[model samples]
Target: MTDPSQTPSLDLPDGVAVTGALKPGYEQILSRQALELIATLHRELEPRRQERLAARQEVVRAIADGEDLDFLPETASIREDDSWRVAEHAPGLVDRRVEMTGPTDRKMTINAMNSGARVWLADQEDANTPLWENVVEGPMNLRDAIAGTISFTSPEGKEYALKTTDQAQLPTIVMRPRGWHLDEKHITVDGERTSGGLVDFALSMCASATLQLEAGKGPYFYLPKMEHYLEARLWNDAFTIAQDALGIPRGTIRATCLIETYPAAFQMEEILYELREHSAGLNAGRWDYLFSIIKTYRTRGRDFVLPDRNAVTMTAPMMRAYTNLLVRTCHKRGAHAIGGMAAFIPSKDEEVNKAAFEKVTADKQREAEDGFDGSWVAHPGMVQTCLDVFDRVLGDRPNQVDNTREDVQVTAADLLDVKATPGEVTEQGLRANIDVGLQYLATWLTGRGAVGIHNLMEDAATAEISRSQVWQWINNDITLTDTGEVVTQELVERLVDEVVTTLPGDASNYEEAKRLFLAVAVADEYADFLTVPAYEEMP
Candidate 1:
């Protein structure tokens, strides 16, 4: 006998009072229904929830076990001023050239060593010959092919020179791995393997050959098909071991990693960060990445076969997402962001070639606009075009203005007045105003201590317009020069004195400002001019 007050009571609305438990028949029905609903939900969601939980756990484990994570060996830190070190050894920097040596508009094979590509890749994996033939012809045949006498019979029985006069202008060759050789432990000899035991041997061969080739001219390598951080780590380890064996410095070898797989996309930032000290840059491998995704994720029972390679376009959202991520990731890490390679343009027809060139030019322009510093061209004929596009897009301009200068207000009306017709404003007045504004922009961008100015305007064409105007003024020197050369410090001082003697309205201060601005702008622009061999000796 419990007291009624001691029992807990449910407070209910007037109409909804307490009731006894349901009858057995109704209770059994409700219990069965509830159990069925719960079972249905568990069947629907258990696998998915478990998958998510497992993935989350994997990430947590990876972070928690950081010591086990593969990382590049510690190397010497690169100074801010040393950013351009790779440029020194780059053959592209010297000749502004890259040549494609391959079968070329026909069924043929090519080697990286003889192609004179600053970076050569052995075409072992993709060559038509059997594994043994590729291995034998790999470097040896490439040497003979580079020499003057090699020739091959076309499928139609027409004779063609293997070593064309065009090869003379080619620069740097890069070797690519052939066959099913990811590393020493995974060698697909005769299209079969026993224990995946020789993968290290294959990787070592690649690392050794790459280092040997890089020893003389350009110290560079292009690492392809990197699927995981451990893959990259393995290569770096092999590189380290090879460098020690060859007496080369640990970080002397510069390499570019190809992001050609889905997993590699997510790990790009981590990979770049891991190999920051050793990596030259990362490239988007659109075709191979697509192939990998389809092969890895597509259900075996489904009819998900991809179309022909030529029919495929790099328009997939995933491809663009990966590229955007790579660009953002590289720039954030202070590394160069190289856009993906353009498709090899066919045909020597002038109209056909020009059209192809224009397409590539447009592609490179878009990349430059998106903040990529450079890209790859398969044909040597496209090299100059690529450089010209980059030059026009990345025109030399000054940095952003500091807060101190941002407050310096110029009325819109005054800006319009600077461009007044010849009769409306004197040449001196127009020149002085333009000189002042340009100087302010340049000084702010370059941090007075900096030498060159990088144009930051969104419209590259408009920046070029401004650059042309400034160069014209310096070249003509109608106002402040007696000789043809730029107006010197002494000439500027004399002009200021003369102007003070004649004109008014802050004339002295304005002249002094104009002189300072013009001098620095000229120096900055002149440095860029020196980069062009023809302009090196220009007055």
Candidate 2:
């Protein structure tokens, strides 16, 4: 354990306390100016953050009372107005043909920069655990990454460095900060923990926004887990304030909102309208969208219960509606329509690589044909896979925003057509959920978030969909197709026990992982986000 007395001190801004230990370089990242920015934002906007979060609970409560969600009538004017469009794409973001995403560690940063993708999503959200060290070092890595001085030497003597031969090929860095719902317990303002999103946004902007601007890309971001247009407005306000405080040009920061939540999907046009000045576009965060569906209507009935995670592909009818609507909304507003993640990681096995590559190729081809400007890939090896597909469609053009998909018209009923999704809940699917949830939680507790399991990169989003499905299954008494056994709380607990024994013994966190998984899985009340409770367990 780190000795509290030995922790370094900094000249913190008024009412701001760095309860987390400050390492040698941490003070530079959390400089006096950065703290001032954080403090100011906290004081000015914390109440509104609280209000938006409270509004989420209100929606949840209303849903439990059998309220069906639809586009807000009050915001109908914003959606109906076709005259307004987001500001033109910023420098280095005009052609986001292929973007790579991963946790922002020294090694991953170096590899992603060299991955040949157009944009690197330096993920501080689902793909990262907010360990105190990571909270400080993630921004540090990003700073070093932008400066072209980042390198890493693994304990096994393997060396990694950013490719200097082709500097122009370096991916534009688009940082994904933590969402509004989380708090940075290590940093307190007026005796209250500060917003984790604010901490990430402030530190990263302070450290690298100017450098990014000089490099031709402004401070770009991917906002996640927002459930309303008001949340987008909050981020727009933050961007305006941060740019002014940092002396960067107004509208220099461009952000793409992830329409992951069911509520967000309905308000896509309004969300774009809210951040039109600083909007890059919107991404189809598919995994989290499914999780949001289960979370929003888990109590409604079998109509809302989805099948196995693997069975629900992007081609599913309901998914098509969501993506079609996203593309239409974004393009109608003259914004980029980025597609969902292709999470398959290529393995050394030839057969596995061939099969996964075919699927990835088909997936990317579909997105390109569907008029998405670009899409996301989780692995460096898959960069070429995604890039080639977009290259074929885009040719000399930067993007396909002009393809407004005017023919596509999605109603509230279309977006909520969960029963139209094909596939079945099976015994194998149930066990996979149990297996993945426990394994992911175990590694997550140990402060590693982007984990590779069974040739796919598993992040917090995948784990969430996994465990949330289990909870929904148990509550609805879903029957496994193969076994004909009803999914009960007892059955889930028994499966959890079996999965525990099967986990690698070397992973010491599995015991705690089991307890945490059960806490979210079989609890009487559903947890809003597993990461919320899991954050308390982080080192």
Model 1 lDDT, residue 250, Cα? 68
Worst 10 residues of 1 by lDDT: 398-407
TM-score of each: 0.44, 0.98
lDDT of 2 by residue, 229-347 (tens): 99999999999899889988788999999999999989999999999999999999988999999998878999999999999999888899999999999999889999989899989
Off by over 4 Å in 2: 1-8, 165-167, 506-509
Model 1 per-residue lDDT tens digits across residues 477-539:
434322334433344445444534443344544443344344533443322211122111112
Best by TM-score: 2
- Give the residue spans of candidate 1 off by over 4 A: 1-122, 127-130, 141-170, 178-219, 300-312, 348-355, 394-539
